[model samples]
Target: MISAVVFDMAGTTIDDRGAVYRALRSAVEDAGAPVADADLQRWMGTDKEEAITALLELGGVQPTPSIVSATFRAFRATLDDLYRADPPVPMAGVEAALADLRARGVRVALTTGFDEPVVGSLLASLGWTVGRGPAHTVDAVVTTSDVRAGRPAPYMIHHAMELLGVEDVHQVLAAGDTVVDVRAARNAGVVAVGVCTGALSRAELEAEPHDHVLDGVADVPALLAGREARVGVA
Candidate 1:
């Protein structure tokens, strides 16, 4: 039985409209490393700062601390401006899905590659921040900045489990719209679910070995309703 469900933010719960990719590409290029969009997309679910550092190295820029810091600042500014100009768009039925899980007495959390401030702004705009309202709420929110590492590293997922008081990875379900999302869940020994709603496609997500793949977030609760326990709580 699943005790908690962790979800990716952009693309998984919110309709990012590719803002993350666009902002990162622009910021990296402005910082003197003309990163390819495809390369940026490949590292979509990791920390943007780490992703920028990798891009800088890939683009032959030596990735000094000053350079990485400068690029990340630019990325933050660009993303902030985009959000202010147009508050993020939520995915089709994330609220309903969250409600369904909550109704089933399952804990819900959000894990993201975004930094804290960005997540706050996005959540505030949607009125889902802490103490906002009860209609759409999550038990916890974890970000790359909050963890030692991001997706493909399992730290964020592990941290989410910690916050939700869930000790067993087998009792968790991790869902996101990227390959790293699946990899992170697998690394944490939980069920990896890929959704074809944000960044990756059904075929692209299928390239990974996920426990389940769905059209979107709304299909998650049903998927976990019939799963058996693979391990006991740690």
Candidate 2:
């Protein structure tokens, strides 16, 4: 049985209408660093600061500390403005899925590439609470700001496990919509699931190493039930 499940925020659970990608592209361009669609997509589900530096380097820019910092700040400001104009909404069936998982005694945690301030604003916009309470939607949240490194490094996932009191990696499942997310789960030695609710298509996500590639976050509950049933039969 899976004791805890960690989910990615933006494309997986929240439908932000691709605002993050737009903000990232705009920031890199404003910093005079050319960013191709493919390059930017590859950096999706990663820390904003690391993504900026990587994009700058890929574009032949030096990616000095000052430039990276400036670009990151620009990205944050643009995202804040965009979200203010049009607040993010929960992805179809995601809130119900979260509630169902929690009701089943499965601990649900959210891990994201966003920092604390950004996560706070996003959650506030959705009116979702964290921690243990009747009003809470999730058990814990792990963000880039909480870890030294972001996706493709398992720090955030491991941190979520720690926070949720899930000790065995085999008892955990991590799901997201990006290659880095899958990589991070694999690096953490947990079940890696890819969902096609984000920029990447099912085929694109399937091309990466993953345990399962589902159509959306809503399918997660059924998947977990199937796994548990199989275990019971065994």
Candidate 3:
């Protein structure tokens, strides 16, 4: 049985209409560095600061602390404006899936590359609460700001486990929409699921190391239910 399901926020659960990628590209370009789509895709699920640094380097700019910080701030400001102008909506069936999981005694957590301020704004827009209480939509939220490092490292996933009191990695399922998300789950020794509703497509996600590549977050509850059935038969 899976004790917890850790999901990525932007693409997996929330449909931001690719605002994050656009903001990142705009930020890097405004810093006199050109960002390639492929390069931007590689950093989708990682920490924003780290993504800015890597994008800067890839764009042939020296990723100095000042430059990275400036670019990150620009990205944040752009994203905030974009989100405020057009608030993001939850992905189709995501809320129902979350409710279904929680109703089944499965803890649900949301992990993201966003910092606290951005996350707070996003959640407020969606009117979702983060806590272990029955009224909360999620058991916990682990952001890049909460961990030493972001995706492709297991720290965020491990932190979520800690927050949810999930001791065994094998009892966890971590799902996201980027390669780093799959890598992070693998690094954490948990089930890695890739959803094609965010940054990557089915073919792209299927090329990575993952246990399952689903169409969207809404499909997660059914996947877990199948696993439970198999376990019962065994």
Q: Regarding lDDT, does 2 or 3 come out ahead?
A: 2
Q: What TM-score against the true fold does each predicted structure earn?
A: 0.92, 0.98, 0.98
lDDT of 3 by residue, 42-159 (tens): 9998999999999999988999999999999999999999998889999999999999999988999999999999999899999999887679999999998899999899999999
In candidate 2, what are the lDDT values of residues 1-234, reduced to their tens digit? 798999999999999999999999999999888899999999999998999999999988999999999989999999999999989999999999999999998998999999999999999999999997556999999999899999999999999999999899999999999999999999999999999999999999999989999988899999999999999999
TM-score of 3: 0.98
Pick by TM-score: 1 or 3, better one: 3
What lDDT tens digits, residue by residue, belong to model 1 across residues 102-134? 877788889998888888888988888542125
Better of 1 and 3 by lDDT: 3
Clashing residue pairs in candidate 3 are none
Q: What is the lDDT of candidate 1?
A: 0.85
Give the CA lDDT, 0 to 100, for residue 116 in model 1.
Answer: 89
lDDT of each: 0.85, 0.94, 0.93
